[model samples]
Target chain A: MSELYQQAIKDLAAKGSERLAVPDASSTLDNPLCGDKVTLDVTTADGRIVALGHVTKGCLLCKAAATVAAEQAPGLPVAQAAALADQVRAMLKGGDAPALAGLEPFLAVRPHKSRHDCVLLPFKALAKALASF
Target chain B: MTQSIRSIIPVLARAGFHYLDNAAMAQTPGLVVEAVASHDRTARANIRRGVHEMARRADAAYDAARQSVAAFLSAQADEVVFTGGCTLALNLAAAALAEGLGPGDRVVVSAAEHHSNLLPWLMLAKRKGFAVAVLPVGPDGRLDLADLSMIDGRCKVVAVTHASNVTGAVSDIPRLAEAAHGAGAVLVVDGAQMVPHGPVDPRALGADLYAFAGHKAYGPTGVGVLWGRKEILADLPPVTWGGGMVAALDDDGIEFLEAPHRFEAGTPPVAQAVGLAAALDWMGRLDWAEIRAEEMELTARLLAGLAEIPGVRVVGPTDLAARVPVVSFTVAGCHPHDLSHVLAERGVAVRGGAHCARRLMTALGLDEGCVRASLAPYNDRSDIDALLAGLAEAIQVLG
Candidate 1:
């Protein structure tokens, strides 16, 4: 509703950068009542992400999380993907996470504690891809 | 004038029994305090405890209330077994009939049943290894009974809802009952929605058993009536036991009481019963058909308005000609919760999400869920207009 929130949503929607990360498997998180769902695609090729993407529906936070997580941890290993999910989770929670370039899109999301998982969508998808492998 | 949101609304933001969002939690009227109030003042003693003046009075009130509920359903007082609520009543029906069945004993259930009706039967089949046949509903959310013909011979019990809580589509219960009976299965109707939508008479419906919740019908919470045939009640097994459910016990085993008591195991919700009785008594005094017709008019108006809104998909029957005021819908490209949130901000109460019929929604692939708007006789035309305005605003916000 605010200008920053609107801007953040627009920036995420632009989704200028696309990446095929190493970890191919991902986890899906569904908020049943809100009907917000995100599947994180995690793929591990030789124990590293070779490709990553997400299919999601919900609020701006959820969409932004998927886009940010994918850009941050695609080429990383299982450990790196998990760690990045943690960072995304931290950023969503208003906790401190290192300033990875693409992750800056999520800075607007920090104050809303309730949206932590929504902002963590992409990485969760990747985790699932990894878990399955 | 619209009924504006006096405060923030409820949101169904998660799953589980308490998954109702802040909006839903906010919208739900609290009856616990009210339930307690009646308990201390009237219907206080163990109802029908007997032999004392106070007990005698309580017994008369309670038993007479039972008779009233029976009459409400066009049944005999002895045929009604008051349970904790709809859930327990359904469990009573399913578990009782499910007992003593061998492998291949079939149970037929519609996909539109609420979790209260579906789960008990599912558990019964899983535990007993009976054949469970699930029938589907057409897009209108009513049973596609042409598909039901396939369930013949295998169905030991046919369980379905009188009206879907999610979609508000009224099922043809009498027809379904006939089909089940022809197949040698008893028909169990979950009337939670129907009872609230309008008055209902289960005996006339020819259903072997009917389960309805008091709260939704303007009665107190935690009290419900399950009306079954006198013969059917005698045949059912008791799932719970305590002071009243039993007649006598020996070293050999425990002997249960007859009809209602056999199922009602403990200290009943006395205040809740009294309140439910009061609600029923109040309802009986009203000209009900007029109330229902007024509600139908309101629903028709709401449905027409919703139809005019872009991206709105009303999920129940197309024939607004044959349904309750309860309605369900999904907004294309917007999650139901988002739509619900926008409306709540405007103070229009609505139910969002799967509505506890998880498997049915899954089968329909409406897993994200839809928004439900249930109207009572008290709701009026202004409410419909307000709901339409609120829905339009919600769509704009999402877009």
Candidate 2:
């Protein structure tokens, strides 16, 4: 239960509606159902991500996911962020994932399987943004 | 309107409706399923031809289906022309119009139109060099009715959606018709969102062309109806040519026949048509006013619950009066996608994002978009409760 609380907090804090700054690169993703989207921007210094920023006009989940990704992605190496995203995917997909050690805040999300893609939207946007550059 | 019937639908069930994300498709009545399967085999033969028993049965089934849709919509059997879906109906109108357009003519459309309603006009405008007049919508997703003044000299046709698929705002078609008529322009309506939930009188609305899909109306997919006045159809060109659309083929070109058959190409949908007919048959038994009343109740509950959450702003009008139950909104703290996910997890189904109304969203100052909860008549009390409960849970957990 404590783990669930912590994960939920971290998960809840990441919203795509709010702009969060990243170290490098930029990207945007769309959610077609309710007509919402999140735009992610980042700046990379050296091999490390140094800043993250975002602007969004969507609902809570998109804004929260962006905020969380912004807060978490800074100081995370580009490769590590990529790896972390995969872990987050595993954690989001299954009941148990060791990569979720830092993702404990999102543990309460197990029941929302259909929305797994929405929760992962920020990372996908960031990845797409970075990949383009 | 009555109590005995209300308790039987899925919305009234304890488990609620989203486990399968399928309403009519899920738990299709045993008899209906069997009927569909049996008719599928029987309908393989040609209609209005062939003396075989199989062909006769197929023709009977097809005719029966068309009659059913006609009765359900309160239109004559000749009014319904089964197409792929609502998009096809809109496309057909555009195609017919395209045949006559030489250039310099203007087409008037609304900014709040869904892609299905807007794209065809855009394509036509681009290809034909016809001026396109985009009607504006109010900040709350209502049509800027004054824009009707823009329908002037150059306007050759008016294309508009009866209701916005995104904001659920119902446009005043009668007023729009008056403007179009005043401008001497033909009025075309995209009824995809309007026909299923509301009552419509094509003649009363004074539209030359009207189209809608069966899928959203609790009917089968791949079947839509385009209702055009007989005179208008007689004057307009056909969208496709072949099999069903032809009257006679000989030396100097071909002569086309009457409506419906003129627009339909190849072998008609047959099975889908039957399913749509069945859906329409069932729909006729319903008291639409009661359904609208129920939707209003659900809309109120959904709006109240959404409004209670901080940073959660419901888009569209605050008044539930003129609008249907399709609700779209954005949140200050959460992205609609994220919020939709949270709700999705809780077993509540909703749509999020721009809802294919980019111009309307842009005009409303919502660059990203909003979350939408489109309520169907099948949605009852428990459905609304579940949605509210899920939203509250999402807000607490994420906000």
lDDT of 2 by residue, B1-399 (tens): 423434444343545454222211222323344557778766667676769998888888888887787676567777777788888989999889867774778898998888878888888778878878899888787889874667986788899988787777888999989989998888999887777675577768888888988777666678788888777777888878778677888898888878778888777777777877766666667788878888788788878877887777778887787787787777775656656667776777776677777888788887667777877665656667777777777766654
Q: Write the per-residue lDDT of candidate 1 for residues B1-399, one digit (tens) a residue.
A: 012211111222211112112111212222333544655675467864568776776777677768878877878888999988988889889888888675978888888888899888878788999987788888677778886775588778889998888777888988888888889889999988888655678878889999988777667678888999999998888887678777789998888889888888878776667667666665666676777778678778878888888888888774665577777788886667656656765667777778887866776678678888887655657667777887787776666
For DockQ, the strongest prediction is: 2
TM-score of 1: 0.82
Q: What is the TM-score of each candidate against the true structure?
A: 0.82, 0.81
TM-score of chain A of each: 0.72, 0.72
